[model samples]
Target chain A: MTHTVLVTGVSRHIGARVAGVLAADPDIDRVIGVDTVPPSSLTRGGGGVALGRMEFVRVDLRSPDIAQVIAAADIDTVVHMSLVSAPSKSAGRTYMKEHNVIGTMQLLAACQRSATVRKVVVRSTTAVYGSSSHDPAVFTEDAEPIEVANSGYAKDATEVEAYVRGFARRRPDVSVSALRFANFMGPGVDSPLTRYFAQPVLPTVLGFDPRLQFVHEDDGVEVLRRFAVEDHPGIFNVAGDGVMLLSQCVRRSGRPTVPVPSTAFRVIGDLARGVGRVDFSPEQIALMSYGRAVDSARLVEELDWRPKLTTAAAFDDFLQSRGLFGGMPLTVIDWLATVWGGGMKR
Target chain B: MKHTDTSHDFGEQEPGTAQVIPITAARRRSAGGAGKADVEDRLADLLAFLRRRVAGEYEVDEFGFDPELNDKVLLELIRPLYRHWFRVETLGLENVPDEAGALVVANHSGTVPVDALMLQVALHDDHPAHRPLRLLGADLVYQLPVLGHLSRKSGHTLACPEDADRLMRKGELVGVFPEGFKGVGKPFAERYKLQRFGRGGFVASAIRAQVPIIPCSIVGAEEIYPKIGNLRSIARLFGLPYVPITPLFPWLGPLGLLPLPSKWMIQFGEPVRTDEFDPEEADDPMLVFNLTDQVRELVQQQLNRLRLQRGHAFPPFF
Candidate 1:
């Protein structure tokens, strides 16, 4: 069915790409992109994303006018991707929390009030699972968060998901699909993890090596586009196959790691944040200590789709985009290791 | 032997000795050359392994099981302790399936849970297929700093039904200690006595996955630390199951942390088929409880028989 789609958070790369992709679709009748600012001003990667056949709407989603837009445009699909994962320097934690939680609440409320909205795709995060020692190795959709997110974007995502679930209940006609994405990584995406890797040296929790997964920004946009035009329902985890050890990632990026005690890691993180070098929140700290991985079987089974790039391949792409070089050539390192390890064997 | 004795007794055997010298010398020279060639071949293999690791061309399963790391490094590190320190002897390894998934239910002991490590090494080294055992560790194992990281890298995961079910469904060998901290921290007097299994979660997981339960009994781990006393205050402060006061622990301080060199034996019983029951029976408490009790009894009987055969924890070398 040809339908009108309202895509929020269009200023960012993922949002812009999703909006553009949806607009380019022959099936989608109209794609309305909304954000507080236009796509170019806050866009990171030069030239920004092309809006294509889509129309841009500059307005705060929490404002009552969002409901008016949904009702007036007769939007059939609401794609909510505005939830911020990191606390930006320009915005405080409180603002980010409010923007994520309240903005989601307002958008879902608008969707709930509008009879035209048939499908709601909320871009959720795996952070809702909460990284803790008590967590299962892989979290399925129905798994409870062993460590409840008490603060930061993790908590905000939890509240946002809860609101989306409540909206689904109220508007039984609306098919809600929450895509709990792993850390997004790609050449065009600028996430906290990218910033963390952009640094020359990485400070990590001593004696702890976390396993991390990522979703390429291209995959993120494609997944968003799929949900926007499709009828898949229920929460799904979207991540590339396999996981990379934090140390392995650092090695692959050719960055030196300074292993700090778990307690001192917080101090160093705070110092880095205060210097405006990298954004480090408590949840991110917990993440770096004990990483999170989610099972994307549901997504694959229901949507008949899979990520194009594996975690390692996506990481390599990110490294290349950032111009980071490996420390020693694999051939040389292997030769040295063989000579050394072989000599020891003798 | 007769020639050597005669040569030692008579000085006239010098000429006969001279005739044997060149043959022995030639043999030694060729043996030395072969040793060098063998070393070079091994070095080449090491190079290839290092290359794969450097390029990140290795696979780690969803449960964070680094099979490459476990097979190459972690197991190697534990080998010396298993071969020399514990002198582990394993039996009934043939009972383990060659390829298909099986749940190994073993008794947990050794204040430090060294028994689990020994059991893992036994399965990997002794089993004909050389299957890698994915052990299910308690949350405490994953909560520690170095220990947790190493455990995960070595192919161990948190003791949860989801991980167990996932591992078994993937046709991977999974090991679990139903006793948990209770069996490990019990007093020295209660060493061989089996503790209550936790809620039959492992049984349900095996049933759901349709994997056989391999009852494993480990003897000699009980005497490794000999948990004679517990420092309750210290244990509470550190959030440990127990602060064991072995004879030499607190007295010798850091040196006492070394595990006692006791002979170890691990025996895997015949597979307890879970496929006979319906998968829905996993949710039935009565069936789950009965199966759990039956597995527990099997492990207990094996433990008693093995302990009887072992005679004593530390046997004197003749």
Candidate 2:
């Protein structure tokens, strides 16, 4: 069963990896990767005839012409992964509302127009759950969308989910599945998780322990692939196998972590933003102050998908793959110091 | 505002119209009180009456101490609940008088009004003084059905001058949430920032009644049900006191009302004896207002300190 898959935002990170994976799949006859800019070295192609299966289209998802481009490809399954993950750099709510929300609506409309389209998988964030300590027992497909603080990123993510759900209700034939993913981390990833590692010195809230969950980039691609092939019709918590402390991630990444008092951290985050050295908006800082533990029981049961790597293992793999852990014998020592000193003490 | 001659009523007289004087009805029945009963016997009867009223068909769970044997059931029932959910650490019980009048002013947070209840229970059960702290509840709370009944039973009265005066005259320990709506209603963006308190009603009451004012700082209440956001329309539509989006709300939707288990530290600040100050000083608006602001500011400062001292965001349970 040869299927044509249109994966958006394939110029970087999870999108690029997903495009490569889909192109490799024998089930997928053609993989059309779309991004606003042309593919760079960071993208899927290494410049060879081997890239014949994968086609790169430089079309902004936010643009109205995206529908025409997707239609031209005769896409059977739409894997919508394009989104502004960075709160600081991303366009404001107005842009998100247009690009993420309206773009999604347009993509779904175009997919619906093609009678061959069977499924649509939208990449959502666990940010919809906000910051909760409550063990959601099992974050099933039916779990209600929770509201985050009145920030534009949360609002945009929520709006995107709403559009997908609404479209699914209207077009039942087009099996729509939304993956409420936690933080994504792996080699070649440039998310907040990777950025934290790349920093020379990590700044953490002094009194607060942030319990974070991550989905490895490969695992993220796997989930998307499964969604494309499978006929699932609901939301799922697509996260890593287990959680890790933010402080631990910083220390293990071989970065010096400075424990600034929470008040002082907020002040520093503000000061850093003013000088343009760092990008910690006040909203991001507040969001980072709580535990974002999500249950992925439903994803395992329904999608038959289990996360291959935990955050700790993934972080280690990421560092090792990048050759960043080669000289840093202090990684284990830093982890020990963080754990013993109650730095990661939740 | 024109002051009326009637103690409780403050009505305006219409222009060119005769003033309607309030009629004080004489008691239809009278009882002799010259040497009828001793103070101890009268006190016991009064306590019994209060107990009967409070225990009237309500679901009373005596959390600790035998239901039949315990002298103060309300205190006993609430103590265990507080200890279980909030590991309440109380300090400076000595500041609270064993008997008689004192004004307790504490910072407020957690969209749900648990701090007031916890403090009341703490004073009643854990305090060495074993005094009942009568709280000044907002009018909005008293307007709610079940809440109104429970509040009164739990020794909360309306935050009115007359109510404060009456309670103080009876030698009851009064608690005032001076921050009122502002403190609890402040957005999640400004969690610990103390709101401006109204002119020193609490201070005037303390000075008028010649009582000490104890300022208390309550940590952990702010985090128990952290208001992450507010759905203004929903809150307004439902006529809810406040629409709070805690981690649970965003994580579990409507089920976020359940409080997180946070360790609470209640530090009672040093008492400011109103008796030491001149009675006329209470009327000196600036003096009383400054004193009240100082007390409020002190609690805010302590809360800020505790936020730094006690490490961990979203409570330890998270």
Candidate 3:
């Protein structure tokens, strides 16, 4: 049993949900959520329905002081969820990297030295397998890194996994599980990919319809809970089954798409980023261009865990939550009917 | 591990979560309020399926095989060509395994891959079991935009040892054109001449899966739009494999693009069981080469036999 749980990056939605779920677990004596900054939102009632005995820790993982927090808490299972997918408005690229790379390193170092730490769950992404012309159609868990990752969250996560491996090697007794998730989509997830889709106009590469896979925001938190509680001892790829093409996804969201040239996407993305409209990071652009997908056979066959939603189902759930053609939108349609009839009368 | 109260409480999802009604479902629900003819109803059904597919909700299997789109759009569109123009006839169809998975090693030909498409339609429509042949395609097939999505939705995957092995393991009948671009772009004179077959990769995949290899020989496809020449520079500029300069294509324009009605013959030869050899023997180059040579010779012999039996370059359909 986990006497005390130290969850990193609790400011983020996924981290907060995991912390909330763990705190609610009666078997867990204490749940501490660590974050340098504050959370973005808390109004999510259904999707963010996690509440329990979660304590807060305001410590930066880049600093050496994080070790004191882990050692002091007597944390047995350390769930590191603090890695930022993309930096917020106040922070720059350097801050995001520090929070991801440095935060993960400090947390791992603290875990390595601590005698009480027995379980470690690190949230990673499949972006480490960069998209390219040479990528296999379906990526398995042990798929090699085909292209060199120069910079971005992809590199940060790659470096984070390497350090976690190094730490695991040093302390064989500790159970380290790295979960590499695909793109996240749901009303509550609010990832850059989801944001790109939510835009009124979706820009896609002219001659590419890369396949995309997404995990529901709820499933994302649930998987973290499973890893933290269960003793899964290896790297696993997490994503809902099935894939959707880029063009297909664009149409599904009820958005008109502007087909831009492959090279021009970066310029448009940078412009969008500069104006605070969207964070079209290189990883996300590559994703929108070629798209990425991972096989989760091992997650099911080995870990004995299954997600409730398929990729299509997850996107459907997101669409429903977004209130497209549902809820009050129907009333607006009703108004349109009355106005059109009145105009005809005139 | 200590179990907790969190299991029953949070495990059950909060009620009244929203569900996105597929556009087709939404449209049909509204369309049903107004009555229509049977033909209109069928058209509405097809349109609804296409709309839902475009807006997503088309289900893909474990290997990214989209069956609904395959049946509704892609295969439905190809039915006319398979049945009417370039009508294809299968000989010794029983040589194909009726139930289990088998690797179909067919000769690739014609300026375009109408032969492969015809073979797929033949297997799908005329075969005893009507099994869909999952054709292993090149990287180009998956990289192209609109074509790529259609190909994947129609159950064509990248031709690789990993995929071939996986499909056969799943008992899915897979089709392969081992001759590849060589046979597809070969000149009219080299019509029936087989290519190198790419180092026997498909043979090894069959051996790994311990399935049978069915040697498939196709005739009458080469005569359709016979490639007399190729514009190398122009094709290179467009990033295509090669632009076939057919006798009528560049001169007559789109009219020349239409294939002449040819009586095509698809002959499936007896199966060569890979189970006889050690599954580990897939690594042995000599055995693989000998087996590949044997199959190639068998296909060559069968091709000649079918040609002799047909007795005409453009045999009339019976």
Query: Number of the top candidate by lDDT?
Result: 1
Model 3: colliding residue pairs? A9-A82
Report the lDDT tens digits of candidate 1 across residue range A274-321: 887587678888999999888998988887988999888888899999
lDDT of 2 by residue, A139-234 (tens): 344555343546645667887888888788878887888899988777667765567667777787554445567778888888887888778778
Native-vs-model 1 lDDT?
Answer: 0.87
> For residues B1-318, what per-residue lDDT tens digits would candidate 1 score against the true structure?
999888777877777777675433454466676776556556667777776776666777666778888888999998999999989999999999999999999999888888988888998888899888899999988889989988998888998888888889989999999999999988889988999999999999999999999999999899889888999999899888789999889999999999998888999999999999999889999999999999999999999999998876888851
Q: Which candidate has the top score in TM-score?
A: 1
TM-score of chain A of each: 0.94, 0.83, 0.90
Q: What share of the true interface contacts does candidate 2 keep?
A: 0.00
Worst 10 residues of 3 chain B by lDDT: B9-18
Cand. 2 TM to true fold: 0.49
Cα misplacement distance, residue A89 of candidate 3 (Å): 3.6
Write the number of the candidate with greater TM-score, choosing between 2 and 3.
3
Question: Tens digits of per-residue lDDT for model 3 on B107-204?
Answer: 98888888878888888878999888889988877767666656766777888877788789889999999888998999998878888888899999
